[model samples]
Target: MFFKKEKDNFPAFLLTSLVIILGVHIFALLTSLYYILPWFDIAVHGMGGFWAASFIYYLLFYTYRGSVRMPCFIAFVVIVSGTALVGVLWEFFEFAMDIINIPFLGIGLSGKAVLVDTLLDLLMDIAGGSLAGMLLLWLKKNTL
Candidate 1:
């Protein structure tokens, strides 16, 4: 019972970790906005799959490690749901920015590709998040 408090404290760490994870999403926000000749544009698009994969791995760790005392089923659900929500939001943000005359650090905007590209964003977001999660497990093991 002594450690119960510590385990319940997972939310704090989870939120911090998620914030850092969300920072990557923030970068995605920048990338989506950089419509023309954007920065590292090719690598960004290609790495989408990898990032989604990490999200998967992150969930795996949350489940396996997090479930020790309390069932992590809900954590898993929350993580997945939250990631998906972010992915959808990215699309909306991109589409909205294009329409609202928002400037992307001087990069010209493009709106015609919003629908198709947003779908791509969703796909890559899933892939990248899932992969990142899995890789994190391996990373923790190696570091330890």
Candidate 2:
């Protein structure tokens, strides 16, 4: 439902993936699966980073098409930076949710718990974003 044309398959796939991830996250929150399964949040953050990186990669490719070839390292850097920014913004949103005491979505974590959670989330984000960057580089090398 998100694609405008056949050539937009990658972006459509990314969007669909993101939607599914969000749905699963919401379901987990509503059902308290996050509490039952402590790793759920980490998994979601990793997938979110991957999806964000994919979207940024798509945009970069679209913007640079028919122009000078962009270095693989440059593309990787952009994708990583974009995904990291998304991760940080998401953490901020979570902080806001905690402040507002949104029960289903907020844990109201503080002290070492917040520190550890944020660190793990950021680590997962970097791992996922790095994977996306490597995939992009591989595709560029193998295709055309």
Candidate 3:
């Protein structure tokens, strides 16, 4: 098998990340918080980054559980890189949504607003990834 079958808290971490992302997203959608609060989108993008990073980290941890050693720096790099990739893809999705003039989840803006929003989203994504990386490192140091 490529990955060792194991019991680990990684699953719990991933589940919690997913729950936070989805919960916040649903709340934002239901209450139009994304429109009412300027920072809501930023927070959602941050959580998206966290979720993406956690998924990538969990996959690596699972894949190398017994056969390979992952240094902290490497883990941090992978988590951030993976989150960036997902963030870029998500931006593309938003661009497509804008092209189609979709509501709610779409950027729905032109020119400067779009540029600023995209940059902020990317920044928040990286920030969230960094936070996740630090958390994972701490957990690994103490528990794994």
- Which residue pairs show backbone clashes in model 3? none
Report the CA-based lDDT of candidate 2 relative to the real structure: 0.82
Q: Backbone clashes in each candidate structure, one number apiece?
A: 25, 0, 0
Please list the residue runs of candidate 2 whose C-alpha ends up more than 4 Å from where it truly belongs after superposition.
Answer: 1-7, 64-68
All-Cα superposition RMSD per candidate: 7.5, 3.3, 4.1
The TM-score ranking, best first, is: 2, 3, 1
List residue ranges in candidate 1 displaced over 4 A.
1-78, 105-112, 137-144
Where's the lowest-lDDT run of ten residues in candidate 2? 1-10
What would the per-residue lDDT of candidate 2 be over residues 18-116, giving only the tens digit for each residue?
Answer: 889989999998998888998998998898888888888777776566364578888798899998998998888888899899888776678999989
What is the C-alpha lDDT profile of model 3 across 1-144, one tens digit per residue? 112332365687678768878888878877888878989899889888888887887777766655656788988998899999999998999899889887776867788999999999999999998898888667766664
- Candidate 1: C-alpha RMSD after superposition: 7.5
The alpha-carbon deviation from the true structure for residue 129 of candidate 3, after best TM-score superposition, in angstroms, is 0.5
